[model samples]
Target: METLPIVPDAAVGAARHIDEYAAAGARYVTTGQQGAANTQRAYAGDWRRFTAWCREHGRESLPADVLTVAAFVTALAEAGKKVATIQRHCAALSKAHQLAGLPTPTDDRQLKTLLEGISREKGVRQKQAPAFTLAYFKRVLQGIDVERLDGVRDRALLLLGLAGAFRRDELASLDLAHLRFDEDGLVVELPRSKTNQKGEAEEKAVFFSPDRRSCPVRAVKDWLAVLEQHGRTSGPLFLSFHKGQRLSRRRLSTFSLNEIVQLRLGAPYTAHSLRASFVTIAKLNGADDAEVMNQTKHKTTDMIRRYTRLDNVRQHNAAQKLGL
Candidate 1:
């Protein structure tokens, strides 16, 4: 005769627990979406470099060993890579290992010490973007002929970028729909930024300048008028041009902003200089850290101090006040 088997009580509870946690387990696939796009891109590129290096050296990359990882970064250091770049490589390795369901060697104690040594040796002073003086800024604006499509767009971009203390991404991400102009001046509704990644409601004001030629508000208005002429009322504030200088619906990239800055200002300057220059100039003109932070949207005063490149020691030094 066939006998019926009895199931243990714990077996039913264990099966129920597995079913209860099924949603959480399924949600794990969305973990990659947690990081910003730029960060994800950097990690991906760094991982490719690391994997290629491993392949060249005949070392395994997926299940990377501590010694191999250490040696890889050492090679990068010997190759004169910056400390930040080397650290990013290690971070990329950690991500790669995590994706493969393995542990990262980057968390190894020896690797941390090596990274500290690299930081000390490399001198953790990152080169700041060169900012413009007010005189030069005015002169550059004066030289641009705003009658053309390219000229107007570039002028508006530069002026708004500087006055608004906007990052490159912020500038590139601008849309006409988010802008609000009042009697005081223009108020930009910033939807997303590096600090506010969840699309918070942050706004920045660009007041009218005493000098109409260099006014951020006026420049933006003129650009809008020109865009109206071209039937571009909404969408990207700064659009790219075609071969014949005809405007396209495509928005300018962050790199394009750098190119515009370098082409207009000089080689040493970049898109970041707009924001940096705002902090430096404002601080020199006696704007406190809080005042500057309000415009730059920086989370801390330390960043303000770092961005303020007041290199004129003779002008800024307290020795003059000491009666020396």
Candidate 2:
């Protein structure tokens, strides 16, 4: 029988150290659960793409050099990726490198200059989601049969989403316990949101409309009555149902919220359209930047102005007021 050579203690120790380092790097990559689910998924995908590119080019991805990063970004630009998307990919790669105890290439002046050049060459015009205006909302209401359980739930969702300028994820994450009803209207306590990532509690008030048909508060009450009839006094504000119409304890997902809007409008409106529509409609109806921001919870006036400017192009144009 052939005798196997014994491995040295130093070689064994080095192998163990390599294994521990790899394990730690992997743990660092996946340990943090910060940000929204969508954001996390996007970052993961971006990092995977970067790693794949590095493997293809025989470069070290964790400690990516500045030239490699610049080339990667340039390739992305050549492939017609949006400037924002390229920037996000860079952020993901930098974060991964940082977590893995490697130096990030993001601070390199050459990489920064390349990104700036790409941004200038590509132009940074983001496509905005179309707004679902009040007129369109009224039309949707006319088609709904509120007598049905689904209709009742949809009406409440639509009104609340519109009036509160809520993101789809925010609406889907709501619980019955977070809502308070009074003579004035309804108050919703949001535990966490995209803006409030630290899980800070934020309160949003939705007032009653004079018209019962258009009143968000009344619509919520109606939905709650149905829930009460079903003996559902707790858990998610919106629940899923079986084909037999029996309610399940499962909360509605954000994707479902998007589907609800698209089905109601019979158009390509997304869940974000509700929030954008609130801003656009508010601006069109003479609401100032401060007023719009108060409801939308926008951190900066610049974003509010973007929505207002689109609506104001025709309605509030200074050139239109002047006779040529």
Best candidate (score: lDDT): 1
Write down the lDDT of every candidate, Cα atoms only: 0.80, 0.79
Clashing pairs in 2: none
Candidate 1 regions exceeding 4 Å error are 1-36, 95-103, 320-324
- lDDT, candidate 1, 128-175, per-residue tens: 898789899999999998877799989999999999999998899899
Clashing pairs in 1: none
What is the number of backbone collisions in each predicted candidate, taken in the order shown?
Answer: 0, 0
Candidate 2 residue 90 C-alpha distance from true site, Å: 0.9
Question: Candidate 2's error at 217, in angstroms?
Answer: 0.8
For residues 50-154, could you state the per-residue lDDT of candidate 2 as single tens digits?
766655665555566798898889889999999989998987777667665567899888888889899899998777778866887888887888877888989
Instruction: Give the Cα error of residue 119 in candidate 1, in Å.
Output: 3.0
